[model samples]
Target: MTQSAARPAGRRGQRLTYLVKRLEMAERARMEEVLRPLGVTLHQYTALSILEAREGLSSAQLARRHVVTPQAMHQLIATMERDRLIERRPDEGNRRILRAWLTEHGVQVLKECHRAVDDVEERMLSRLAPEEAVAFGSALERCLESLTVPPEGLARHGDRTA
Candidate 1:
């Protein structure tokens, strides 16, 4: 059993996984509230941010980066394309491969969202010193590294039963 499962039910909240899950839910809720007025969901905002940093990503690549399925990314890309928030063009060498990029309007919207997100982040980290904030982020990264495993390895170990 997991460490958290070993704990008494009433004290489960004190476990790392429970606390992390709670924090993720609360943060997502707050982000949704703040981004709703801007007419963009957190996932869309994240896609825009990713496109900003790495232009010309395929829908499949974006899905992997976003930790979502390719079908979901395709739907999201279609909606964003319809709204003119993103533009998709065939790759130069491979006509079958479509690359996505943010439009001017999308960039402007992202700038506005950045300000609002900054406010939320500032408020969330207000209690922490700068060093503490950095350390906390590093710790989270370490936890993520520990949990992540190669799919091939999972198959080799027959751990995919669930």
Candidate 2:
């Protein structure tokens, strides 16, 4: 049998997912190392970035954006709050709804983290030409779009409330 046919059908379907997951783990590890001095994990850094662009997001909203369970986000937010990186307050209109916003310190730390992470990203993409980088980004977006369901009753990226 040819090499292609010799491989199990299940393994073929797993190849892409496996590679993507491995890349994600490697990227997270690199980010974790770079962000260690800032006392932030990849998840916290992501939350800070999200809050920087759009403040006052409810935990549920943040959870959806991060593709994490609400329970997981709750723990993350609580830790960030304790670290004074973010503040959580009840919405003025809805007392039951808690909104999260970055503190000034959070913004400052996030800026520093951005610079560090940017260096990491640059190193990762150094081999790709500008056009190739753009193409790769577009391809990743296409893959994400294919896997994600359309957000309903939610603001898209740039439309997020500040």
Candidate 3:
């Protein structure tokens, strides 16, 4: 009998990719549950956090960072603007480009979200020791870089290939 035929099927937990996807889904669900009462989704909170770090990202730039299409990002930006969580202004160098930044209210909301997220993360890492948690984070970062970096190692941040 073949090696594959010798084993039973439906062993999703044994697959690395399946476990990764399952973890991602669980994290997203928990984040959304906590963020819902704050009138923000996980994507919106991510955008807000990004804006806080870099205050002048264009819609296209933000979309690229989020790995989403520009049209979808535009809709998200529109919703954020409607909620007065962020404001956009024409870029000084490029009149056609709109750069976004967090409003005062946005900052307040983001701070609250940070505390809530910190709680979630603390719970998630509760089983691990501090050193183990650090190692786990480093491992995850290495895994991400392995997938994102090009085979030739020529691509930088904005130059990632599909």
Candidate 4:
């Protein structure tokens, strides 16, 4: 039996997973509540940042950067287009390719969303010293890296030889 099986009903990762999901949903809702008043979604804000940071990216490239499928990116782009927050136009070098850019309205909205995220992070992590928060973030990254497996390979807790 797996370790999860040995544990009491729902007293494990699944429970933890649910809690994490709820926390994320709640946080996202809070972010939306703040951003909606200014006319934007968190995903839209992230896309705006990517657009500002990258000079030229096709929908496919942007989708890959965000680890989402092109279809999803198209939908997001369409919504942003309707909101006048972004523009998709043919790339100069490749007519078949499309590039996305943030509009001036998009820039203003992103700035506000950035401030909101900063405020949220500061409020949420106020209990932790800055260094402790940095260290904890680094540890989370390490834990995630440890969970990676070689192609066609697997391990239990990253310790089993395979």
Candidate 5:
């Protein structure tokens, strides 16, 4: 059993999940401060980064990846298009479906955001030794996978539609 699993129930503050959530909140605050000057919210930065990696994704696809509703993603895409950070064109396969890609301006902005976010990440990881940092990331990935992937004969969380 894990250290947390072995521990007797106590204050909620003592839980590992609580500590992880606190860390996530702190990191998000720091990222927001850094990104604010660049006129990018965390959501926008994430969408831009995803578009850079996988161009031509529809808003629905982006929504699924973002774990948000398609309507929300549509609003975000519209905002980005207004900012000239992304362009949408009709898909060749389906003229009705519009696919999104980053513009040159978007790429430049994303690069700047990347550097700023990297600094935030570096600061967050500064306390850990290099090896410890790697292990921590691996452990977090395992934890995420355990939650996201359902056990055999069980339906996934929030997968009722599927």
Candidate 6:
């Protein structure tokens, strides 16, 4: 019996992993600096922002959009409810379904989050020209298309060849 090389391109895969970890750390540090004073984690801030935009969304829908589990979102909603940040009410036409909406407090917090987010974006991209920023973002979104994955970590579309 023989074992194939664990990774045919072992050094390249190691480089990829290191790059991902570095990026994740950098993003988390930036978000923490912006959000820590607001008393909301990045995920929580994101939830509030989404509710502010959509007003009312089911937990499932929120989870799908936020890339969180339904259970995780339920817990987050419970915390937000206790804080009076959001209110959940049964859908009028679908009594079985509950929609989450921003309370006045939620709106206020979202406004703060937006300001913080804007500050961060402006600082991060201030050196870029407007057209260059647009081009950079468009290119990033194209890169993101391949990053989307199913719950099981399988690519939803495109070849996984690497």
- Backbone N/Cα/C clashes per model: 0, 0, 0, 0, 0, 0
Q: Would you estimate the TM-scores of all the predictions?
A: 0.81, 0.78, 0.85, 0.72, 0.86, 0.73
- How would you encode candidate 1's per-residue C-alpha lDDT over 50-73 as one tens digit per residue? 998998999999999988999999
- Name the top lDDT candidate: 5
Q: Write candidate 4's Cα lDDT for 41-129 as tens digits.
A: 77877778888899468999999887788898899989998998888789888899988888888778788888988887777668899
lDDT of each: 0.85, 0.86, 0.87, 0.77, 0.89, 0.80
Indicate which candidate wins on TM-score.
5
Instruction: Give the distance in Å from residue 82's predicted Cα in candidate 2 to where it truly belongs.
Output: 1.1
lDDT of 6 by residue, 52-157 (tens): 7787899999998999999999899888889888999999999998999998888888789789878887776788999999997875665566566543544445
Off by over 4 Å in 6: 1-21, 146-162
Q: Predict model 6's lDDT versus the native.
A: 0.80
For candidate 1, the 10 contiguous residues with the lowest summed lDDT are 153-162
Error of 1 at 136 (Å): 0.9
State the TM-score for model 1: 0.81
After superposing candidate 3, which stretches have Cα over 4 Å from the reference?
A: 1-13, 154-162
Q: Report model 6's TM-score to 2 decimal places.
A: 0.73
Worst 10 residues of 2 by lDDT: 153-162
| Inter-residue clash pairs, candidate 5 | none
Better of 2 and 6 by lDDT: 2
- Model 1 lDDT, residue 71, Cα: 95
Superposed by TM-score, candidate 6 places the C-alpha of residue 154 at a distance from the truth, in angstroms, of 18
Clashing pairs in 4: none
Please identify model 1 stretches exceeding 4 Å from their true place: 1-13, 149-162
Worst ten in a row by lDDT for model 5: 153-162
Please write out the lDDT profile of model 5 over residues 3-67, one tens digit for every residue.
Answer: 86765453563677777888899999999999999999999999998999899999999998888
Q: Which rank order by TM-score, best down to worst?
A: 5, 3, 1, 2, 6, 4
Local accuracy of candidate 2 as per-residue lDDT tens digits, 98-155: 9999999898899999999998888878989999999988767766755563555224
